[model samples]
Target: DSDSKQKKKKKSKASRSDEDYVQSLNSREDRNKSWWDDFRESVEQAEPEGTGKFLFLKLLLNETCEIGDKVLVFSQSLGVLDLIEEMLKIASERGEGLKSSKGFYRPWRKGRDYYRLDGSISGNKRQNDIDAFNDTKKARLFLISTRAGSLGINLFSANRIVLMDASWNPSFDTQAIFRSYRLGQEKEVYVYRLLAHGTMEQKIYGRQITKQALASRVVDSEETGRLF
Candidate 1:
């Protein structure tokens, strides 16, 4: 029994020594880190304010939503939509109870103030959300994936359309814009295309203009042939 107790005491002491060694190593590592390393760590941990394009979008939404105007925001990437949703949530929280053109503006809520539609959502849920947006007085913003929303959906309630990012194909964006500019839409629809100055988005926008011009020429030629 005495031998066993001695063995246990030694094991306990060794374990404590091991723990101290690990703690010492961690402290040493921290001390050895350079100022540049610390700065990099801080940058990594910092919360970003979002891209300039999205900041402008938040401002536009603030202006439009304050005036009781409904908006449809379409993006080619689901990831971009997700980012916009998070940014809008922050904006809503910040603008809570702010006075607007239409009296006091309430904080934007998920199902009441905005709706999101992506390929992952079920058809029934999509239709339900669409119906809600069209019928509800408070529903103002719709964040949609361009591919998922460009076809077979009518957002006649919204008068403002924001193309968050330009698509490679101009037809996709045209369809997205027309989603709000449908037959039942009584208000004049305005489309806003957001593009970064020095990025591939500008190139894509230029390409879209070229493609649209070519498409128009082709259609005109075909119509003339039919007439002949």
Candidate 2:
């Protein structure tokens, strides 16, 4: 079994190098520049707001992922997603930056450019996003909303997930987590839930739990968890 795994890894690596090189050759950017250099310029020049959210995004892009890695990002709210798109534009303009209050941010991962979830993306573009995230020839980041990407989406493409905020229902979060946790993932799926310390957010989380538990099923012992 170990030997078989080694062979599989070797085959995957060889195929990836071939594809990445082909993509490099096919790219129309100045033949003088490699994809990495172009990517760096984009990330650095995109002018993102210097907020806590970008701080987290900086860390996320810095995570270690090999070629063909998949990443599912759940920002939870559309407002936040919009903010992320703004940040990404900054990343594109700035090349690579880590604008944080603590003064620590660096780029370590070799990645393909990212794709933000948008209404305009569908069909093969959607499937290609899924595949590229898995293959790493095209996807380094996948920005998604939990509600949309959670249902009936095949995300075996990559093995990393970051939920900018955990939904009110743990089950909703569960659905989001399972996108990668489903069958055929060769790597461990990492789930990160971000919560602000000592805020109204905690109460919100508790209420969501109570509501989802009720919606999931009926138990006589539970009462209300909603704001009603």
Residue-wise C-alpha lDDT for candidate 2, range 1-228, written one tens digit per residue = 999999998777546412332233333244335444545555543444444556875666655333335567885565566567666655545655432234443332323466655333455676676666666644566777665566667777667788877676677678878888989877878777666766666666776677676765665565554543
Per-prediction TM-score to the true structure, in the order listed: 0.73, 0.58
Model 2 error, position 5 (Å): 59
Candidate 1 lDDT over 1-228, as tens digits, reads 999999998777546412333333444455456444545556332312345677677778778867778999998766566666667666557664223676665666788788998765677999999999999977878998787788899889999999988989999899999998989999988899888888899888888887777777886764212210
Best by TM-score: 1
Model 2: residue 125 alpha-carbon error in angstroms: 3.8
What's the lDDT for residue 92 in model 1? 57
lDDT of 2: 0.61
RMSD of each: 16.1, 15.4
